[model samples]
Target: MDDDEHLLWQRVLAGDDDAFAAVFDLHASRVHRQARRLVEARADAEDVTAMVFFEAWRRRRSVRIVNGSVIGWLLVTTTNVARNRERSRIRYEGLLRKVRVETVPDHADEVLDSFMRPAVRGRVREAFDGLSTRDQEILALCVLEELAPADVARLLHVPAGTVRMRLSRAKSRLRAALGEDHGRSTLAGLGGTS
Candidate 1:
């Protein structure tokens, strides 16, 4: 957290909508970029980013700022929110098929496909899909979000030392799943696929 962000957070905690919006303006692009790297589809990443900010606003009164940055909290929330979005998408598709409705083409996906390949995203996701949910959250916060273990520990309600130990163990399991050749940090690129 920098001096400006700290002041914005203080105003945000004071229920200043404009301050919150300013924070959003400052971080939204990076959030979406990170979300895109994590989620396979553009729409899902957009949904995740939007939901992250929504939850931030809803929980603003209760937010715990670690190192004076709320973006850390939002990034972690994106991981969880993206998972919920995927589950909902699966359930919704199941219902659509049950009703015999033709599935619509994802226009957003079509647009995104022209510029980016999701091959790497798919491989990373496959590796993460094998992990426990607890492991996924820790990896997302510590490795992907680049947040301090102390900050992550505050979010997970554990000791900083315990968070570090768990991160080491989680990385080991991820490496075994993804193979030693895959960089350890790339495991976090899988997002919250679990």
Candidate 2:
């Protein structure tokens, strides 16, 4: 297996598009899964996955392969990509906080606000953001994505029972964050019909 991978990598080094695609096909899912563990949204995870592969190609010469697998390097790249995005998000939020709005109320704004309910959304977002990374990940996988506990367990490499327990606890904490009454309905919505 190691020899096959090494040969394929050598082909990649020689500018074989097919070999590069083969490598991506072999590792894309694993890279995406790792990215999802660090990011909150599915879209962001997908972005990170793409960025990881892009980086792998761009820095192909520097990628380390151990035991015939480049997965370790891919995972490390995923972590760096996710952290960079998080830092960017933080800086953007800080910039938003610094900006002051002093516009007069408009009828169109009122109409949009009436239906959009930005306040409620903000509250829910704030509550969700307050959770620890593990809790957030569990909620994102099981609740937001509506993935089965067993599937999440497999992806996370944890027992199904542990996934269930962590999900329960995470839900409870989300409730605490949003206040019980509001949290119950919101959790159901966020978690879907599962």
Candidate 3:
């Protein structure tokens, strides 16, 4: 939150359209950059970025400005939006897999492998499945969405310090699950000798 941002927020809160546009101009590029890093698809990133701004506009009253740090809020929102998109993609892929399994017997293995590794991918999914829902969401938000810990905390409505602690626990659990001899065997069975 810089001085200019603070000023723009003041005007936005005062109901100035120009001030709102200024806010968009100031932060849109950074938002897009963050989205691109998370989504890895140009069009998807653009759409997500637009949704972030739209959300900001819709929730303008709730957007409090403390020392011009709206960027953190925006980043958190963008991360959540990106995560939603990822979830939607996963569901769509699952439905598609079900359809393909029923209609096309020849491509079942290939379709499953496409969703994950032929053999190794299952271990990865199993490790993820072992985590609690909150742990999984935190991991996806921080690791897959690539958001900063502070931003993740804001999005989850928890303290930044709590985010750090939860992330540490989640990492430890994932590492333990992935490091056991059985996990190693599973990985090997997936055809990844290493």
Candidate 1's TM-score reads 0.46
Better of 2 and 3 by TM-score: 2
Any runs in candidate 2 off by more than 4 Å, and if so which? 104-194
Instruction: Quote the lDDT for 13 in model 2.
Output: 84
Against the true structure, whose TM-score is highest? 2
**C-alpha lDDT of all candidate models, in order:** 0.79, 0.89, 0.81
The lowest-lDDT stretch of 10 consecutive residues in candidate 2 is 185-194
Better-scoring candidate (lDDT), 2 or 3:
2
lDDT-based ranking, best first?
2, 3, 1
Off by over 4 Å in 1: 99-194
Question: How good is model 2 by TM-score?
Answer: 0.53
Task: Write candidate 3's Cα lDDT for 12-69 as tens digits.
Answer: 8788999889889988999999999899789999999999999888888898666666
Tens-digit per-residue lDDT, 1-194, candidate 2:
77888889988888888999999999999999999999999999999999999998999998899888888999999999999999999999999999997898679767646633889889888998999999999999998788999999999999999999999999999899989988887887666422
- Candidate 3, which segments miss by more than 4 Å at Cα? 100-194
Worst 10 residues of 3 by lDDT: 185-194
> Residue 76 CA error for candidate 3 (Å)?
0.9
Error of 2 at 177 (Å): 63
Assess candidate 3 and give its TM-score to the true structure. Answer: 0.48
lDDT of 2 at 182: 82
For each predicted model, how many residue pairs clash, with residues at least 3 apart or on different chains? 0, 0, 3
